[model samples]
Target: MRWFMWAAVAGAVAAVVLAAVALMFAGGDPEPAGAGSAPAIPAATDAAVSEAAESQVTDAPSASPSSSPSVKPSPRPTLRPMDVIAGLHTTVRELVQDGQLKPDAGEDLTKRLKDAAEKLADGEVDKARDKLEEFGKKVAKLREENKLSSAGYQTLAAGLAQLAALLPSR
Candidate 1:
């Protein structure tokens, strides 16, 4: 009986250790939210991003893809770059609207992202992709700089990856 109990405890410990390992493999920034003595969102940037985010919840979900198979419409693009930007924009909007931004020099980087996404949705796939790539790079840079918040860069990277996958094989 004691052996069985020890086995169960060992199993639980193994499970916990495995979960921790998985989380580490999943990749996350070391800093926690509100960890760095700095606010994630700055007031000025938040306001600008919020204004651009007005169209975040787009009335039109999918823009028609080009006829070329390379640009063929995805029957279901789980996380299009535009969609990702739109949702993120909305979050920025709410953050600013809720006065969550700090007086710090941080600027609303969201508007620039939204504009880039609009270029994508407007049938400019190449441009969109370029912009998306740029956005991903920016996100990565911000993360490395410890300027990213709560998996924001990770989500951005995921969105870019989704868009890349949905594209027809070049």
Candidate 2:
């Protein structure tokens, strides 16, 4: 948890730095009052500098920050364990629907897992409560029955952990 907090702080700092650098490179023709901003000149020598900096902002709009090449969109979160679970759920569902996976308890279990993954992905915490609990039990049973490696179960458990991270405690 401490490590996560530190990482968050580091990420925020890095984002600020990158935003600053990107703004500097943009030279602020019409970016927001925050990013890509340059301190207003005294207005006396403005004409000369404006002309000098004019070429830099040609490709960028004089109003929209999105036009600025240096302005980056907000970063998307990387796919974590829950994301992996969603991908696996989608894959397994497709396979089962196509009759690739034999119909039986495995199909039912995979469907339940898929629903739980979907619920987790959708941030439907309450809706997924029972499903998540059942999925854990199912995964545990699979680990025991298949004699799967600790790592294999660890990966599945890691997905559950990611789900937990996304949810509010019951």
Candidate 3:
């Protein structure tokens, strides 16, 4: 009779230990004694394991920081007015080559950009600004006619506007 009682006590103790270990490993919240509720054990899903593995891989340190202060890259230098005009010319030529702009339209735009650059070089800022505005108007017309895609129109218009902004205000 005493051996039978001892066996029952041992079995009960083993069950309690197993439950505690499960709760610890399964990340479950253990219910308080006499709470009359069991701990909610999360099911070990493949997705959960995969997410944990991925997080560990991503969180692994790739490099150690140096004791020296970090240096930042320098800012890009601002473009000159002539450089902007030249860039606009190149952009127009490339668009024509890419079949995005018709040859005739490209030539007209290039001429305007070249003239503007020359005017800028001669200190005729207002004239250069006018030519850039003209180029923008032409781009808008092409967009309206559906000859230029919205993207193309936007690229050309933005370049023209930037060039104009670089010139002195009237």
Candidate achieving higher lDDT, 1 or 2? 2
What tens digits encode model 1's per-residue C-alpha lDDT throughout 84-168?
Answer: 5665565444333433322131244565567677886787877766766676676666667655543344444444554565444
Which residue pairs clash within candidate 3?
Answer: none
- Assess every candidate by TM-score: 0.41, 0.40, 0.55
lDDT-better candidate, 2 vs 3: 3
CA lDDT of each prediction against the hidden true structure: 0.54, 0.57, 0.68
**Residue ranges of candidate 2 with Cα displaced over 4 Å:** 1-84, 90-106, 117-124, 147-149
Which candidate do you rate higher for TM-score, 2 or 3? 3
Q: State, as a TM-score between 0 and 1, how close model 1 is to the true structure.
A: 0.41
lDDT of 1 at 116: 72
Please give, for residues 1-170, the per-residue lDDT of candidate 2 as tens digits. 64345435434544553454455446563444566667775765877888878767666557655654675766544445366567446544543454333346456667777787677668786767678778778767766765332333444455555555545676
Q: How many residue pairs clash in each candidate?
A: 2, 0, 0
Report the lDDT tens digits of candidate 3 across residue range 77-125. 6557787677677767766766667888888888888887788788888
lDDT score, candidate 3, position 85: 76
Model 2: lDDT equals 0.57
Residue-pair clash count for candidate 1: 2
